[model samples]
Target: MSDKRADSVAFVRETFIPEQPAPSTATGAVKWLQDNLFPTWANGLLTIVSLYVIYLIVTATTPWLVNGLWNTESLAACREVLDGATGACFSVLTERWNQLLFGFKYPPDQYWRPTLAFVLMFVALAPVLFFDLPRKLLIVTGLFPFVSYWLIWGGTIFTPVVALLGFVAGYFVYARFVKGSFAAGFFGGVAAAIVVWLIGGGFIPEGANDTALLQAVPSRDLGGFMLNMMLGITCVSLSVPLGIALALGRQSNLPLIKGMCVVFIEFIRGVPLITLLFVANVMLAYFFPPGSGVDLFLRVVIMITMFSAAYIAEVIRGGLAALPKGQYEAADSLGLDYPQAMRLIILPQALKISIPGIVNIAVGLFKDTTLVSIISLFDIIGMIRGPILASTDWNGVYWELFMFASVLFFVVCYGISQYSQWLERRLATDHR
Candidate 1:
């Protein structure tokens, strides 16, 4: 009995009790380094190299960030202290921040106009980003431009009122009669836009009587970051839909239409955007009749739209191709016509798939708007360049100005990337 009890106790202890911890030297930080950093010969070599690189970066960066001579109060002070040494000049950034945010030409008292426009733009765009917004209210978002123009320009109310009426009438005619197809809606919208332009441009003799109002807001006075934003947004918004149509046309069964689309896309994609801008700036006049001079701003916008559209078409084509043939077959089996299949079934899925790619392209286009500097447009980057080169007080401020601009671009691009990621996650869930 005693022997049996002793045996049972031994078995119970062996089964229930935990083993003692391993030796300290073979675990914790040392074990982690062994397993992760030096798991193999190659890994050990890589680990050592990476650590050395990190050490070099840290040593190089610490002094510049914490103790560098870049923190002077003025340009002269900075030059005096640094004396041919290389470091960032952050003081210039502090002094010229206002000019960077709002162009140098913008009057200090009238800075409110751009600020207000910027705020309104964000408000109008909010609904687009947040899916919880009522879709029906999107019409108001589309009208935001007219509202913003009136607010910024402080024009006679009659002009904006007339434009708004024409727009509403156009929307109704297009939606009810034109049936929302691209061709009908486009032509109808164009007709409405023409009417608005006539009213704004004072084609009517009575409308022309508002000379004081027209004189109050001159075309030359309208060049700045606000102009850049307007041009970029309008061009992109118009181009994206056109691009969708072009992409679909390229993929269509009709040989003539497909061939034309292919030629256009290939031709535009082959040329550099700078060449297109130069053509708009120089060659567009030759295309028009002798006395009909197009606005430089309008020409630039046209060029940007065409360039962006071609690229967008390619991206959308990729999305369309990625879709399974089964999807097309399924749509046909459901008795839906080609247009119905595309609009209701195919495009939504395809566009969702291409959202991230499209946003990336958009960010690139936004950054490229800086190229307007080449054509004498006073965009933010262009404005910075002038002051950096011309100003006695701000000369040699390239590092500060470039750093600030980089941060601005980074923030905008990063936000766009994050939003795209969120959209991707949401769409993934919907697909599942």
Candidate 2:
């Protein structure tokens, strides 16, 4: 009966079947293409249409790119060389590349200074962006602002040295007083820094720049892609911390603090960035002492920082609100104070949630740095419109010039986007 039952069971394997590779049609590139591009008849048709469109675009652009004149001195020369062939006058980019990077007024001899500063910026940012790096590298990050300022602006070393000292003094004061009251410490730190600056101002000799190793370059001379990068980086850095404070303040139990934060965020958000920029360019001067003549770059930084902070505050507030009640309760149960709770627990989670929004704001803020061109600052676009195109050599090379600018902006924006995605993945601790 057992033998008959075994025969009826029909070939139960005595040994386990060996694992085999998936079929070529069910794996690898072929499978992926089939699943993604041609899973359905409709998708296959759409893919074919898309390919045709791409092919057409490539055909249209290939000749222009292939025949582009890079060595010609002028658009006319480029056209003569092309002799009515479909081609691009890309020589403008090669010729005016310096002016497109650093404004025409920046002394060509001193170009190495800004170039060095630009390179050091990456080194300074590495530790801050990638936390797995040695924490000691943060010292470089701390000194970078002053060092880069000295390098790019090229003045008496005393200028940045004094600035650094002022910050050091402010930090000490903040550290000393923070154990007592946060507000007192904050205000005390500011007052100390101001005092340090005032004291340091007297020590810098009036003829310092004349004797300095690197000749001073005034802020007005800063332009092109360099100016945009500086403004975008500096403002984004300043705004993030300020935005966090504003977000926290808005949620404060103190009505005064909350109201002030609310008003600032709402008012700033209500006003257009260009309007604020106009205020920076034209109106802000009236508020400063008549002889003070604060740098336009500084004014623009302040306005942009404030504008970006408002949006970031709203984003962070949303992030904070997204947290479950248990998170806050857990902090309270741990016997933590408000500041301690925020620093240790609440903020990390909230900031992780807020990363995407903050990155969006940052990318937008970087692009908006081009708007400074409208106010007569010669950012890359300003260089293109004002100097490059206005010149006889490149008068008609609009497409090439603008395309170069677009490429520059796209590279920076894409990098920021990629980094943000990596950061999000890194911070995603929840098991899937």
Candidate 3:
């Protein structure tokens, strides 16, 4: 029986040939085209049809793009330059580039302040976005908010300094008490920050406002793409942490805490973003104490943050719900406390699961920033629909201005999408 089994065994080859390239007909771009684009008769036919459609589009658009008038002052000049040929009137973009970017009302001399902040935003975001970068660089990320606020708003440096001190005090208090109780520490930290801010307000000098600073720009002066950028960045940043807190609260054992979170989320989610924005624009002032002077930008931020936080909390809840019971059991088995287990084990996994949903919300929120134009804020859409199009020079040239806005938005939204994809790939640990 052993001899017969040995006789039935497959023979192993003693030596193998070195690797070789595929045949010319079955390799490179030619092979890829054959395999993917024209593997079958039907596929080949579809490929040909699609190629022809692309050709038609490119041909039809080519003349307009090729003959685009960039230097001319107005639509009339662009038409005169084009004469009888098809051409794009892009002169509006060139002439109002500063207004399209910095808002027509923004001080031209102080353009460098916002411009510098805009450039530095990417630097500030780098360490946070790409964690593989040096951890020490997070100091720059931490300081960016105060710095950005100082630059864009041109307030007395003392205001931001006071704000930073409040945060620093909060952190120290939270660290001291967090080991004992999360709720106690959190509320304590918040109270500490408020106390610091209130006290610090007393020390700031009245004369300190205009001195040692760039000219202060009102929130009303902020417009065009800059407003959109500001709103999107601030809201996205604020919503995530608030969302996490809400999600945790919703899942808590305490009835009061859970009920409060549930009610807040439900109320916010039930309301349309446009309604919230309208309130921010006109109605929210009535809710504040009499004689209070809340900036439109601050009101808008609060509304958008609340709106986004509710949705983000729901997304995070779904992530938490998707986790296996065993995950919680394993954390408990390790003898870790609730916060430690959540921070170390559960949330990392849940957040990974929730990333796509979170990013989708973020992108949608950014696009929704354009809706602020309905309230008379001159964002990119507002700028186009108001200042740019209303001008006699660009009155009838709709396509070029709208197309520029579309391209700018597409570039930003597309970049965000690409970053999310890269982040997903980076965090993937399944080995597949």
Candidate 4:
């Protein structure tokens, strides 16, 4: 009985002690530090280097952000604040905010038009970026010009009337006859648009002489950032379907069709954009009848569209090539015609796969719209340049204006890139 009692006591002692938790080879903050910061000689060195770099950045940035003289109200105040030491003149940005946001030439009463258009653009773009918007809603959203024109140029009914005709004609052609084949739909819409324009007497505004209707409202050079957007959108919207056709042609079995596509793509790609723009400006008039005169802005739009389409064709060709051979073979096996197979199966998949790449190209094209400033168009950057040079009170404001514009562009491009990433991920899942 005593022996049994001793064994019971031993069992209790062993169970209660719990083996001292096996000494826990790594635990607490010390272990974490050792693992992360000093796991090896290389890791320890990297940790020390990273800390030093961070210290340098903080020491440099803290002074500039908080105690710099450039944050002062004026150059004189800046000099007094920092005792003539160096720093960024961020105050200049706040001082000329109005001129930068709205050109000094713009009337204050009309500022509301641009402001409202800006807000609407953001609202329209938000759903396009973040949500899986219905196709119908997308079509409506794309008609921003109609709403914006009513707000901006309230006195002129021509803009909204044209927009309505375009929307109606596009819907009729695509929804009814063409059944959403982009090539057929686009051509059909164009034909219908011409008919609408003729029937609605668009070429003859009521009570207006031919000369008055033909007169330019504003100089091509006076067009602002909004004008740049309009040009880009108009050009790209026209070119996309054309680009797809070129891509398909380049991939065609017919030698003549493929050769034509190849020549067109190569010829456009080989030339500089500036040369093309110059041609549009100087030589496009010769192409039309002797008495006919083309609008300069329209000419520029045409050239840019053609140039952009060539690049888009190459991008889409890459997408087409990436598609599996089995897809083409299966379509053939199902007795589908080339156009039917491509429209129903291949193109949908290919376009979905190419979304991210296409968005990247679009962002590039958007940024390149600034190049219009070189042709004397007063895009935002051009307007800013004039003010910086002209304003005696705001001399040397280049950095401030440029930085602000850069930030705006970065935000827009970054948003587009992020949206593309999301679309790619969503499409990847759908394919699976």
Candidate 5:
């Protein structure tokens, strides 16, 4: 049997062939078009119709953009230049670009301050957003709020220093008691911060700001896209932690905590955000002690933060509620305390589930910053509606100005959307 098998003809190649490119019919551009565009008769028809529609849109709009009047001084100049041609007067944006970005009232000399803050924000956010970046960069992240506030507000060095000190004190207090009890650490940290702020308020010289390197810019003077970015970023950053706290509180066994969280969430959710903003603008002052002199900027920040936190909490709650009961039972079985269980296991999973909802709410909140215009605060829309459009030179140039605003907002919202998608892909462990 062995002799007969050995003698039988069986082909074996001596050299292994290198891999070659797939056939034209099976790969690359041709294959993709065949599969996606002409997979069936109906798909082919749809593809043709879609292409026709795209062509129609481009044909109708391309001349308006291509013939845009970009170098003119005003709408009048733009109209003269266009001379009946289908075109956009992008000149309004060019003429008043600084006012659109930094507001009309912001000192021209100090324009770099907010601009620097905006650029630095990307640096601070890099580690938080990408996570693969150096963890040490988070120190820059931690100091960013204080540094940015000083830069934009141009306040006494002592004021931001005191604020930073309060946070430092809070962190130290939290570190001291966190291992013993989370509640003790949390409440203790808050108390420590408040005490530091209260005490430090008296020591800073009032004149420290006058002779300071950068002159203070009053809150009333803040306007344009800068104000919108400030509100959106601050509220979003603040609300995430508050939202998480409210979500946990809602899930608490403690009757008092659960009841409080439920009441806050339900009441806030019941009211429209515009109503809250109105209160923050007009009515909140009545509730404060007489002559308290609270800044309008501070009030608006509080209201926006609370409004977003309520929505975010509900989003996070949905995430938490979707988890299987077995997860909770397993944490209990492992002798994990509530805080440990939530922080170490439950929250990471729940937050991942909530990412889409959270991003949606964030996009909404950023857009809603326009509502500040109704209250007489000049954000991007306010700048357009009030200053640029109402002005003699740029009056009637609505399309270009609004279109610019739209593009700016779209860029930010789309970036958030794309980042969320990237994050989802990164966190996917099922390899699906």
Candidate 6:
């Protein structure tokens, strides 16, 4: 057969031609540029117009940024240096950098405390954010809230110690009761915590803060970016678990639980967050026992946590709803109880599905922390609009100061967004 075919063929090459490289337009940068930027006439025109607009923006802003005066003592000094030139007075950021970061009222000498806490935040978060890290590192994650609170608030060590004790007691109570009934465990845990706190409160000696190693810093003294970060982290941490509970309750078979969850979520979600902040600032105090003064910061935290949790519950509910009914049937077939099914089978998938929405709420909540300034809490924005801008030296440095704030927010929000995308990719189970 081979001989017949060879004879029938007119001619055959003894050797094949060497392989040739593809054309530039069909590969590499040129191909990418064509496919992405200029796939058609309309797209090419849009790309050209977009490039022109970008060029105009760059030309308009470059000189101002390039000529920025960083070393000057004041906006006036910066202007003097620039001599009526198109330049940014970045001296405001340079001069009040401490105030922008740690707040005007934060003790300069004790700045290391918050700074240390901030640095340690990464260590605590590392295990949770990157699960490949040693699981034992989660002990640090568990202790961070108490440790950070002590560092930043700087009260009697007994305060955090007692708080930790209360939680420990609550955990033991919950563990003891949970085997029989979840409700008993939950309410018993809460009651145990309250009892521990009440008993511990009496044990803390009066003026313990005065004799403490680190000086007490009142919540009123918390300001600037530190305050914003603290609020963002605290509210997000508290809200997520609360949100998960609410989401589950909303779907429960029990009418009382479902109705209450529905009412709470709807009421909180329908009202503007600003209104809640106002309530936290003013009306919330009235609810506390007469002269049993709750800290303004705590009130605000409660409000913010409640606000964020409602939105997150809705997001998680959507995720729960998205799951196939077959998943639930599979859980039943395995003879898993409701809690076991949710924990071991359902929640992990729902949470993965909810990641994007959860991250969105987190980012938005972080940014919304700036609203605390309106209640006189003096977050970073509050510092700018209050002290920094009002100061005689930096009065007119609007663009530079606001630009710095914008950059800080952008970096944080962008990081959250990127992490969410990474998490989504990592958790993706389906084949395209």
Best by TM-score: 6
- C-alpha TM-scores of all predictions: 0.79, 0.93, 0.90, 0.75, 0.90, 0.95
Backbone-clash count (model 2): 0
Clashing pairs in 3: none
Task: Name model 2 segments beyond 4 Å from true.
Answer: 1-24, 180-188, 429-432
Error of 1 at 261 (Å): 2.8
| Pairs in clash, predicted candidate 5 | none
Off by over 4 Å in 5: 1-26, 173-188, 429-432
Off by over 4 Å in 3: 1-25, 39-46, 180-184, 429-432
- Model 1 C-alpha lDDT per residue in residues 37-142, reported as the tens digit of each score: 9999999999999999999988886655454443466778877887866555677766666667766665667667667877888888878888788897687688
**107-177 in candidate 5: lDDT tens per residue?**
99999999999999999999999899989999999999999999999968898899899999998998888
* Tens digits of lDDT, candidate 4, 184-284: 56557767876776566546455453333222243342355666566666677767777898898788677887898899999999998888888887899
Q: What is the C-alpha lDDT of each candidate?
A: 0.74, 0.92, 0.90, 0.71, 0.90, 0.90
* 1-432: candidate 3 lDDT, tens digit per residue: 999999999999999998998898799999999999999999999999999999999999898888898899888898888888998988888899999898999999989988899999999999999998999999999999999999999868998999899989988998788676565566678789978987997799987766855677889999989999999999999999889878988998889878999999999999999999999999999887677577899999999999999999999999999888999999999998887888899899889989899999999999999999999899989999998888888899888888888898899999999999988888992324
Output the worst ten-in-a-row residue range by lDDT, candidate 1: 212-221
Question: In terms of lDDT, which candidate is strongest?
Answer: 2
Per-residue lDDT value at 279 in model 1:
90
How well does candidate 4 match the true structure in TM-score terms?
A: 0.75
Residue runs of model 4 more than 4 Å from their true location after superposition: 1-58, 67-83, 126-131, 134-136, 150-155, 170-185, 191-203, 206-238, 253-260, 285-296, 332-340, 429-432
